[model samples]
Target: MPLLNGDEEISGVLRKYRNIAVVGISDKPDRDSYRVASYLREHGYSIIPVNPTLKEWNGIRAYPSLSSIPGDLKVEVVDIFRKPEAVTEVVREGLQLKPRVFWMQEGVVNREAADLAVQNGVDVVMDRCMMKEHRRLLGGK
Candidate 1:
């Protein structure tokens, strides 16, 4: 199926999937990745930051990669912050983790990656910010 907008389906996925593995999260507070992660964390969703370069952010232990996260960590969504060219690899890794959803941030879209995710039975959202969607749909701020 082609990528869908933030309608009922998208909102349902987000509402149903609570834990999120935030790939490409930055240490800098000014970055979109950081803000998104913070928003998710504050809004009661478990935020697991995936970045090889950081050990921790905002008191949360950061995993180097999705595979490195402890097996017990329940990841419902993989919210990606990387570029379009880099999304496929992240999506591939996300598939291994078996998250229910794969979300590419605004300005990041990869048809191949999105297709791979859908083929694996994972819901895909592209070119949209998870934070914005959460605030819009879930009344999160």
Candidate 2:
């Protein structure tokens, strides 16, 4: 199998996992990361915000990095919103959590990062928006 899978695998990922650590998430409601995270949260998925710039948002504490989220949090998915160049580091750190999936949000792609995640027994998705995929594949808005 390739480092990243196709749509069928993506749909299975979206359906099977719910705890998402949104890296590079912005507190600003207008930002794409915030919007995507909020969408996921509204759809009944747990959203864990990860950004060094914030201590917390709304009420849930925002972790500074994937490595900082508590061990008991059970992050099922690591949804990355950082630039392509920054993904490798995030993937390396998030591997510790042993998440089921490493998802790079729309326009984000790093083959190296994806390969590392796949090699470690995690599914990978690159350059795709989870919100959009859910809507398209699962018949959401």
Best-performing candidate as measured by TM-score: 2
TM-score of each: 0.94, 0.95
| Error at 97, model 2, angstroms | 0.3
For model 2, how does the per-residue alpha-carbon lDDT over 1-141 read when each residue is reduced to its tens digit?
A: 344557788888888898999999998999999888888888989999999999986578999988889999999999999989999999999999999889999899899998889889988888999999999998876
Find the number of clashing residue pairs for candidate 1: 0
* Model 2, runs deviating above 4 Å: none
- How high is the lDDT of residue 31 in model 2? 93
Clashes of 2: 0
lDDT of each: 0.88, 0.89
Total clashing pairs for each candidate? 0, 0
Lowest summed lDDT across 10 adjacent residues in model 1 is found at: 1-10
TM-score of 1: 0.94
lDDT (Cα, 0-100) at 32 in candidate 1: 97
